[model samples]
Target: MDVVRSKDGTRIAYERRGSGPVVILVGGGLDDGSENEPLAAELARHFTTYNYARRGRGESGDTAPYALQREIEDIDALIGEAGRSSRLFGASSGGALALEAAASGLAVDSVAVYEVPYMADDAMVRHWAEYVDQLTVLLADGRHADAVELFMRLAGSSEEDVSGARSSSFWPGLEVLAPTLAYDAACLGDGQPPVGRLARITQPVLVATGGGPDPHLEGLRPSFFDEAADTIAAALPNAERRTIDGETHVADPQSFAAVLEHFFTSSGDFRQVSL
Candidate 1:
């Protein structure tokens, strides 16, 4: 893994592959470079892929008093390391971070975000914070299973689906990453203010939703994925929105790769196309 030092001197880790224009894949939650290796490999055929571990994971350094800006700096350092002017693909919370970085003027050439859970409204944000707190307490009490349950519940997953995931091997790993849930929540804010700050992001942007997946909670208002995509598209000068039909919050790589290929290879003036 190649290493770059963030502004705070934290050593960030990333894997560079493929050989055309550079594209960085930033995963959400506890994901490191390895989790996205397959997607990176697929994209490698067309672009130089830089798959990186966010701070506090893999080869990266972790300092106390974590601030959201530090995360942005981490991406900034990686973009610089990749020689600037690279395309970016960020999923979940990573999507939110990527959008913020682009808006902050980090020189992203093109960008695509899949289901960034921005609480584009106030009620959603409050409920999200409550869920974060509930999950935190569950984790503290050694209730990893319950923590996952709470998370899926907050995310609007059905009871049966949550129960099924509990038996899956991925559940344990998610538990380990549960502590960082608050970080994602914090970045999203209380859903009141629109992600207006991101309006300045000029990079050709694609805001996407997984049409296959339902809202995490039952009776939850409008879909978070739609909310996020619309919020971003409305803000950016050059932006489009797409929904990956038959794909949910947890999507197959092939479907995602197809959507990505279209966005990255688009010609003309950044037309909004739904795949």
Candidate 2:
């Protein structure tokens, strides 16, 4: 893992691989950078990929009294190492971090984001604050497994699904990474989409949703993911949106990479459906 020091002097660990234009892959909630290795390999054939552990997880060192700007600085540090004007591809909440960075006036050339679930409603807002509070306390108390379980439940994992995950061998490993869940929540901002801030990003943005239409719903209506993709696309001045068929919120990396490649290597113009 290569080391880059954030402005606060936190040691951010990342793997640098392949060659060409630089691209940073940021993973979502409760994950270390390893999960991005596959995506990195696929994109590595084209771009030099910097797959980094967002601080507080994996090999990255964390500073105390976490703040959201620190995470942006971490990304900024990586961008500095990668020529200071490279594309970024972030998944889930990591996408939120990348967006926040671009909005904060970072030198990001472009950003391709998958499933940044910004909580944009009153009902979601009411419960979201409480969820963050509970998650923070759980991590503070070292209840890693409980924290992971809570996150899964909040993400709509069924009881059977949660139970099956616990019985699996991977559950324990995931529990070890569970403390970073709060970091993801914080990355999403203080429980709202920075609509104003996001609009300030003049760089080209690709906001996309995953998953095909529900087989039960007969593909007749838009899903929540589609709504989110549309809302973000509408808010951004230079943004395009798409929904990748058959890839859900968890995301399928190869499909996502294809979209990123197209967006990154284009003529700085994109098309999107008008709402």
If scored against the real structure, what TM-score would every candidate get? 0.86, 0.92
Specify the highest-lDDT model's number. Answer: 2
**Model 1: per-residue Cα lDDT over 132-198, one tens digit each:** 7786687668786676577677667777788788788887777766656655655665643245777
Q: What are the per-model numbers of colliding residue pairs?
A: 7, 2
Residue pairs that clash (backbone atoms under 3 angstroms), model 1:
121-191, 155-216, 156-216, 156-217, 157-216, 212-247, 213-248
What is residue 221's positional error in candidate 1, in angstroms? 6.3
Model 1: lowest-lDDT 10 consecutive positions: 213-222
lDDT of each: 0.76, 0.82
lDDT of 2 by residue, 131-231 (tens): 88898899889998889888877676767778888999989889978877878888876667788998999888988876665332332234655666777
Error of 2 at 248 (Å): 1.7
After best superposition, candidate 2 residue 155: deviation in angstroms? 0.7
In TM-score terms, candidate 1 sits at 0.86
